[model samples]
Target: MFRWAIIFAVIALVVSLFGFGGVAGMSKDFAVILLVVAVILAIVGFISRGKV
Candidate 1:
């Protein structure tokens, strides 16, 4: 999941560099969403681990 976010972020950067504004924006959004979800899941897993 985290890997995917990095991929999308890199894609966004490359796309933006080439001047594909819309595509880059979409990729950036996906990257941000994936990053948030990954962080949330990681935190949840860490907290749950402490209980067991």
Candidate 2:
């Protein structure tokens, strides 16, 4: 999931550079959402793992 976020972030950057505003904005938003989800999952995993 984190990897996918990075991929989409790169794609967003590239698209923005090429002046595709709509695509860039959407991809960037998706990348941010994925990144946030990945972080939340990681934190949850860490906390749960420590209990064992």
Candidate 3:
């Protein structure tokens, strides 16, 4: 999931450089969402590991 976020971020950067405003915006949004989810999942995993 974190890798996916990084991929989307790279895509957003490339598209922005090429002046693809809409695509860049969408990709950036996806990256942010994925990154948030990844962080949440990581925290959950850490907590669960502690309990175990």
Candidate 4:
């Protein structure tokens, strides 16, 4: 999940560099969403580990 975030971020950077604003914007948004998801999952894992 985190890896996918990095991949999308890189893709957004590359696409923006090539002057594709629309695609870059979507890719960047996806990266942000993935990063949020990853953070949430990490927090959940930590909380669950404490219970175990």
Candidate 5:
């Protein structure tokens, strides 16, 4: 999931360079959402690891 975020970020950068404003914006939004989700999951995993 985190890797996907990085891929989207790179896609956004490439699309922005090509002048695709809408695509870039969408990709950036996706990247942000994925990054947040990945972080949350990571935190949950770390916290739960001590339980077992």
Candidate 6:
């Protein structure tokens, strides 16, 4: 999930550089969403790991 976020982020950068504004915006949004989800899941996993 995190890896995908990075991939999309890079893609967004590349697309933006090439002046594909719409594609860049969409990819950036997806990357941010993926990153947020990944962080939330990681936090949940960490918190649950110490369960009795």
Write down the lDDT of every candidate, Cα atoms only.
Answer: 1.00, 0.99, 1.00, 1.00, 0.99, 0.98
- Residue range 1-52, candidate 4, lDDT tens digits: 9999999999999999999999999999999999999999999999999999
lDDT of 1 by residue, 1-52 (tens): 9999999999999999999999999999999999999999999999999999
Q: Write model 6 residue lDDT over 1-52, tens digit each, in one string.
A: 9999999999999999999999999999999999999999999999899783
The C-alpha RMSD of each candidate to the native structure, in angstroms, is: 0.3, 0.5, 0.4, 0.4, 0.4, 0.6
List candidate 5 segments past 4 Å from native.
none
The Cα error of candidate 3 at residue 15, in Å, is: 0.4
Q: Which has the higher TM-score value, candidate number 2 or candidate number 3? A: 3
TM-score of candidate 1 against the unseen true structure: 0.98
What local lDDT does model 2 show for residue 37? 99
TM-score of 5: 0.98
Range of the 10 consecutive residues with the lowest summed lDDT in candidate 3:
43-52
Per-prediction TM-score to the true structure, in the order listed: 0.98, 0.96, 0.98, 0.98, 0.98, 0.97
lDDT-best of 2 and 3? 3
Give the clash count for each candidate: 0, 0, 0, 0, 0, 0
Q: If candidate 3 were superposed on the true structure by all CA atoms, what would the RMSD be?
A: 0.4
Q: Which residue segments of model 6 deviate by more than 4 Å?
A: none
